[model samples]
Target: MCYFLGAMPLQCVSGIFVLYSLCLLSFSPHCDGGNILVYPVDGSHWINMKILLQELHTRGHNISVIRSSTSWYIPEESPLYTSITIEMDEDVEDFFDVFLQEHLRAQRDGTSLLTFFKLTKGFLSMIARAHLLWSDATNQILNNKTLVKSLKDSQYDLVLVDPAIAPGVVLAKHLKLPLVLNVRWITSGEGHFVLAPSPLSYIPVPGSGSTDNMSFFQRVKNMFFYSLVLFQEKFLVGPIYDAMCDKYIEGGCNIVSLLQEADIWLFRSDFVFDFPRPTMPNAVYIGGFQCKPAQPLPADLEDFVQSAGEHGVIIMSLGTLVNTLPKEVTEEIASVFAKMPQKVIWKHKGEQPSTLGNNTLIVDWMPQKDLLGHPQIKVFVAHGGTNGVQEAIYHGVPVLGIPLFFDQYDNLLRLQERGAAKIIHLADVNGDTFEEGIKEVLYKDSYRQNMHRLSRLHKDQPLAPMDKAVFWVEYVIRNKGAAQLRTGAYKMPWYSYHSLDVLLFLISSTTLIFFSIIVMVRYLCYRRRNTKPKQS
Candidate 1:
């Protein structure tokens, strides 16, 4: 048995090494360079992290990881990762696997809602008692005497922090190593951009650029929606993330501060999925990092698709979250497909929608990328997920996006404006609208042409997103800190960046004063014009 004590990989016994040497005269590949430590939000992230780690190792860099026990609903019986094997404490490993198994099973059965709530409550509890929790178990993990001692012993060079589980940032700060943060979404900077209401009417959206063409009443409704989102963030999300990171992760252990103290920032987006990049210097859009189509579809499925012929095919999926929208919403979407001229292939996790007809093949799951690559795939109807959007662009497939929440709406709008997709409101969505949207996508040569152009533009780039991410990551390690790219804007308050309320106040005050002046001038003019008024 090999023993992993802290960070060192050691032989359990001298006699075992001797025995192994006697049995085989093979040597392990020589590992080199500074060690890298990774922290991600479990499951596929773990898998992706391991893949990167192995690639780094192949280039001769030593690596160690501190992954969370949570699996985020991926099945437990499945292997942790395909590329590398990890050695963890047996008890910890067992607990993690068992937790994943139970949670994943519940997720499959649609009973994970209560479990999710309970976990959310615990997270809230930890946040509420952050000071205590910080000084105790959670914070200790980051600055654990054992882990730090290991890193110091190994002389690890860089630390990668996943903003999702960012405790490692505190650890990085404590150790004073180069830090890198992996931003998953528009979570930072007050959460108002896409999540909040900013004169961005969300509910009764008529089309992609509806705001630009909206009536005054429509604008008012949009502003109302935007304001409600801001209220939610101000009261809820902002405080929660702060409480989680500030008190518990960093302050107690000095790990997160180290992470925030990191020299480089990596924003994962290829710009294919998002439009008009955020104005952060170190932030690079590395989305579509996993854009490659993994494998070909099964022969039987290929034949079925090929048999469909000139009618073409429509692929329908709501991505992972809201995979099961309300039955009404599903029926509306299905009815639209029923009336469509194309054959539809719907990737639904629930029971087959009753409205689906002979032309529609309602399956529990489909090879998303593979289906997109198919010549018969005419259009995509998706929930405007980052991954889905990227895939559609990669395969030159046009989309009908029905965004549900978060960045999905923004992504859909961006694609719609680019003429590669169309957006429909989740609330007022129906069969007629869906059918009309599909017809437009099919008849509109611009959407297909634009998607093809985008695909070419993406491919013509100097480097792949993954390559860029890896390069920048290495640059940080080689240069100690990528401070040249850091900007002064990071130091400013959130209110200053977006002067929305300030502008509103100025407009309101100016209108009030202008009206007052106009009223006074009119009264004076009337009195001056009539001598009888002056006498009165």
Candidate 2:
């Protein structure tokens, strides 16, 4: 006899029955399975999300990633997750390339004034590019009936969004899913403006590079930068976001409002890496969370490190965006490495300089974490990317930073302040200067000791960053949304948040009382003088 239970076949032989339980179990979803949709901004953003999402997948979640077609950091194919590619126009990609090239060129050749102008222009261009990209993505999602239907049908339990890019909020709102923010930078962007406390008096503005212990003038400067950021967000980026939402998002949501609805915020920084600041319960710091145990190096690479002997080794990488350096700069770097006693492994995509050093090995790519974790590494020569800096901290390696742009300067500055790193600007990077920087970091025991101290602090968290991220992610899914964790400040108006209304009322009342007393005293004096005027 044959029987079926929920599409499972059962067999009865000689009055004994056997059920095909394995088949049912194989078809069933993991006990903690939940559909998670991730919207990443760019290649760099994707790299950070990839780490957190991979962990989520390992813990029985179904993940789907949506990225631009022109994204450079595409993840390897995995049966456990799915990828959705969105098309970007060739012209748009070309504009970004040209813009970055011009900016780098300006930094390489121009004076400070010229560089400032070029950076301003570059920032404007970047804003335009972001607006265009978000607009295109919004239109694509709204216009494609099949894609829209498939997305709605997927029934995602939660959405992991890169708050740097505004379209993620639109997608989450469209799907009506609980939102989780993954901030890929050390500095808080719009997410902090909405959810986190940002007191300009102590907390330096993102690009200011100032520390918490600021002088009176420095605090004024910090306040200026904060105001500039607010102006840009409101007058510049606001219109673009509003237009995009007005076209696609029903009821036309504001970007800040959308972000404030987020259930959890994961920042890519820790107290060790970033200056101490007040954070809300919903905000979780997961700096170096992407770092993992070092795998054995490739045989050839292992042999190269081993060959260095007692002199140790240094790793030079400018992160992903800066794959190629100017030929002159490259030659200078190579020449500097040639004189160093330690072996150098540089990640360079440009043509090898004619003066390339014999002591230096240039590879197109490297497993940076693995190389940093190696016992042979003496110091890391980096562009001061957050990921690179955090990895260096995790491995307890001192850094020689040659910061290029954006948060790289601030990141390097923080490390420099922490006594773990030194920075050499790109314009100041010559053979002699580069060599001096490397020598200082390599010879300085203080740098190494400080790095080790920070590493201990970073590792001393109650829950590992990955586990904390995973737990919160699951918490959002289990609880629908963690509204209780949200700060009440988000709902307060700007006047109420800063107590400006109360201050203004007090000032107005005091002014009114003072004026009334002065007028009454003047009238009494005038009346007394007039009554006695006849006798005078």
Candidate 3:
């Protein structure tokens, strides 16, 4: 090395040193990058997971994504990560869209127990089918000696997976690699309830429609919602995963146990948007990790936004699940947007609404992050998914939420409570209500101001959410696993964790002592009365 440096010019040597330093700046603390094997859920979950992969790839980490052959959002080919395609029984994405449409239609008619039952049945069937396919795929992969040997040879540092599904958790365990969960939802409900201290009185269960502050009735409702989650897991989801584990893993396992075994949870939630709740040390918050500064818009879209001028533009998207609203709902929404002064860019995927206004531009897909970040954007008409809500907070854009299904109401309720958004329930979404909701958000300066405050709070963090996420992932990699940070709470049985057995024992002892004292006092009183009467 000294001989070569002597042969080289001093300027050339300095230039080489400078270039090497520049490369080091892009990497994490550890110089040599770690290999990350990812198993991501499809739809919006995949979108965020893809962002993480891009960042990791930039930092010189090797990434491999295990995806189902029938996945909709996760492409078979991507520069971000090499794909390990698992053969699926059928397409799972379409099931969600169909179920969403049916749910909307039921809500339009009127919400009743029958509607709830029907909608719930569809939702459960979707979950059951998706898990069945994924479990089968995982079983196939595990049983195939060639594929099993190949994955073993890869020697991944960690398995970063979205725990919304069971395959990744099981796969990570089967591979005996350190597990890191990129999660908001697990199989049944929000991930935190499973991993941290979640009090039913305060921590609102997803789909409960309860807030952090709860009334007696609301708390009761939250418990019921929480019970539903438990029921779904115990009956609907858990058995499938357990059956798969029994086939492949030693000493038959379950999904919850595997998830609990995860080393680090890169949770996609922030206290700024999410209610302040108890969180574990290993669970790192990365709420808006996927958000970035706005990019230049396409020429036509730019022209549309610029045409709005001072009125500014409104953008609406109902996440990836809802492709099209019911016909009546669509016409009502289109009519409402038509009457507004602001130009509207809607990510609609149905037949052209007859009532669509000239001011509204409909598209199949949108640059949601860029549009939210755009200065010309005024109001975000959203379905209140976590991604949209976080992006809205990141961009300081007030939301006019029309929550359709699945934690959407709970998501919007947070913003509504913060006075940054107005929620219009799916059943009540007509032209008049939609127009009034939009006008309220558009005219109210407080909505904008409140959101700006949230934006400031969310941005005031010491490290960017994405950087924090990458750091935790690398922390796990660098240290083999983060066992110290992970709490042993999950290992405790429900009775032990809640201290119910101790309570039962204490109660039993107290009752026994009280009764014994009463009996002894009665006996003493009787003896005293009898002896005194005889002496007299």
Candidate 4:
């Protein structure tokens, strides 16, 4: 009777087991949400981070985003995470505005060389402003006892930073969190040195636009550009970042050391879209992760596309930065579009061109990706921005690129090399050349075919880019920084990574052996001659 009283019903036993399993699941690290901090630099970088972070948030991770106030493309607030905005000083902000205006004017009015010079000056100004703003923000954050206390109390799991903004490194150090760098550009500048084996012999510099298949002279040119970039970053920009680190960090760290310690790097490119190159195990390519399926075009836009009938449509946009073209250039584009049988959608912010055609629709903004994905769209006229290029490739649409400044020229050059696009430089834009470029892309089946082939390869990944990125991010959390994936190359000196030490040793040994052989032969010949003469 005592044994029977102690026995439980089968259903009661099952319920107890289920409750115990649930408790264990709740306590497991993999099953729980992680705290993630995301900080993206200004410009198109915000778009890339938003896509990744939003997906992570949807998967139940806690997210916190901090961005500069000067960002032109401010993201909408999400209920899933906290948003922090850092404001720059009025003078710095004004300077940036003036610099942008001058830079754009240079792009429109000057030769490529002059444009490059102006842009270079503007870039230096931008670096200075970035330093000042970051310094001010860092001091503010450190001085605010409440903010500092909160950051310490929160205990973030990981900090995802943009390397373009150097101060983010110092902030990560202050928080004492593991770092994951999200680089939006294909080229990561000096950061590439520590991330992986980037041989300049094949890997072109950011603005050079040369491909991996370069001639002897081109390779030399590539090396020169590479050296110039490294010098600028190391001597010109490194001090600003170091100074910030010195002020805030207890031990103080430089940019090179900070990057070496990074746990993971997510590049906004893939081999299918970019040239094949060696990447570290920790480096992941999630190029088109931000791309989405085409949404239905607005009624007016749909109507405009349908009006063209069999000729299809063409979409032209110069991206967010170059909102307007020079009056003469605008007229050239307008005139070219007028001659085309297809309907044209041009995204322009400046005054309407005098040659504005009846077949063209000029708007301030267009859903670029959605339009690219449209079935009837035949060609994309673009400024060759990375995002735009990626979108055009994803949709298998051919491009007529009008590259202006920065990496635009390089980006178009790559596309042109791939037979997927043709480029007409902004400075060289005229009605005849612009018209020819448009016609060449439109009439040529090779351009469309190559783009389609690339699109297939891009989509053939084992996992979707977004899934791949999220899995790695989570993997880092689950594995506690995933140190095993890190390459020893980063820890090695530059000479060691390139086998320069081994090469130098081989060269020295060969020279010494050759010298010793020569000396021994001379001594034997001298002795033989002297002995023979004495005998005579």
RMSD in Å for all candidates:
15.0, 8.8, 5.7, 6.5
Candidate number achieving the greatest TM-score relative to the actual structure: 3
lDDT of 4 by residue, 420-528 (tens): 9998877678988888889999998999999998788888889888888888788777766867877676667779978999999999999999999999999999999
TM-score, model 3 to reference: 0.89
lDDT of 2 by residue, 151-228 (tens): 989989999988777677777887788999898431124345556777878887766768888999999888877776
lDDT values for all models: 0.61, 0.81, 0.89, 0.79
Candidate 3 lDDT over 128-244, as tens digits, reads 788888888888888899998999999999999998887889888888999999999999889988788888889888888878999999999899888888999999899999887
- Give lDDT: candidate 2, residue 151: 90
For each candidate, what TM-score against the reference? 0.64, 0.86, 0.89, 0.86
Better model by lDDT: candidate 3 vs candidate 4:
3
What clash count goes with each model? 13, 0, 0, 0
Put down candidate 1 lDDT per residue, 368-472, tens digits, no spaces. Answer: 888998888888988887678888888889988877544567678777877888887664566777777878988989999988888887767777877777777
Compute the lDDT of residue 408 as modeled in candidate 4. 79
